[model samples]
Target: METSLRYTSNSRSLKIHAKEKLLVNSRTRLQLHGELDTGTGAPSYFCAMIRYFNPEALTILGLGLHYNKREKLRCLVRGKMEFPVRTGVPVTFNVKGRCDFDQEFNQRNPKGAAEFAWSVMNFQEDQSVRLKVGYEIFEKVPYMQIRENNWTLNANMKGRWNLRYDL
Candidate 1:
């Protein structure tokens, strides 16, 4: 379990987050995560997921909720798969997708985005240094109030390297 409260100087808001994981057998686990922001109109998010692991792969399915100050709520469905690659070095590949819907479960206005992403991570022999590369595409919701039928498509590719050390 983990919990944190942070104050944002620029936004002058307090953000709270909590996460917990439970073992539901030898190969299954449940995770719960939630976040809230005290900034006006900011949305609060909650997610619950169950993960299943086997010798070769891991799979996760989750449901999420987003609630705003106006009392409007949106629902999200997410799924992910991770597997180890047999490359000479230690590597893992991950694929994930998410679908968003409005309060009425319609993929329209105010909350309609579909995203698909994939990533590959390479780890050092000691597992302290890692490199990751990922790409994602989004069927995004329009920013302007032109029409409910208008939508946008976007894509992004990113890479990052990190070094970890224990104190």
Candidate 2:
């Protein structure tokens, strides 16, 4: 378990965060975290995430809840999750979107936060090089209720060699 509250000169926000992790079994773990941020035009977030890994499963399963304190900008409750497998080859899938809640936690507003996204990555490593390729798109709704106007679609490919041994 860990908890912290701090300020950064590079960003104009005061943040408080806490996280806890417990081992349930040899191949399962649960992580819980919450964060409060007091910044202009930003939403505080609370997230609880869990992941499971097994050789027979041949992949890792992850899921979590992402809560937002600001109702005027984003969905009050969003879900964040991902799946990745690397036993033989490396691949990953990711997603995030609004939950069943629309308004803030208070239920005063009847609008669900309008956002969704899906992404995938393929990664390869060799004795001398590492490469990764991925793409993602964020689905947005402009119904005058989201009010945040956060939307983007992106893709990238990269190759790099490790350079940290100071040779």
Top of the candidates by lDDT: 1
Could you tell me how far off, in angstroms, the CA of residue 103 lies in candidate 1 after the best superposition? 3.1
Q: Which segments of candidate 2 are over 4 A away from where they belong?
A: 2-18, 38-43, 71-133, 138-167
Best by TM-score: 1
- Candidate 1 has its poorest 10 consecutive residues by lDDT at 143-152
Going through the candidates in the order shown, the clash numbers are: 0, 1
Model 1 misplaced stretches (Cα beyond 4 Å): 4-14, 38-43, 50-55, 64-71, 108-127, 139-167
Tens digits of lDDT, candidate 1, 78-139: 67776666545465666667776788776643322222222223323333333334444353
Worst lDDT window (10 residues) for model 2? 143-152
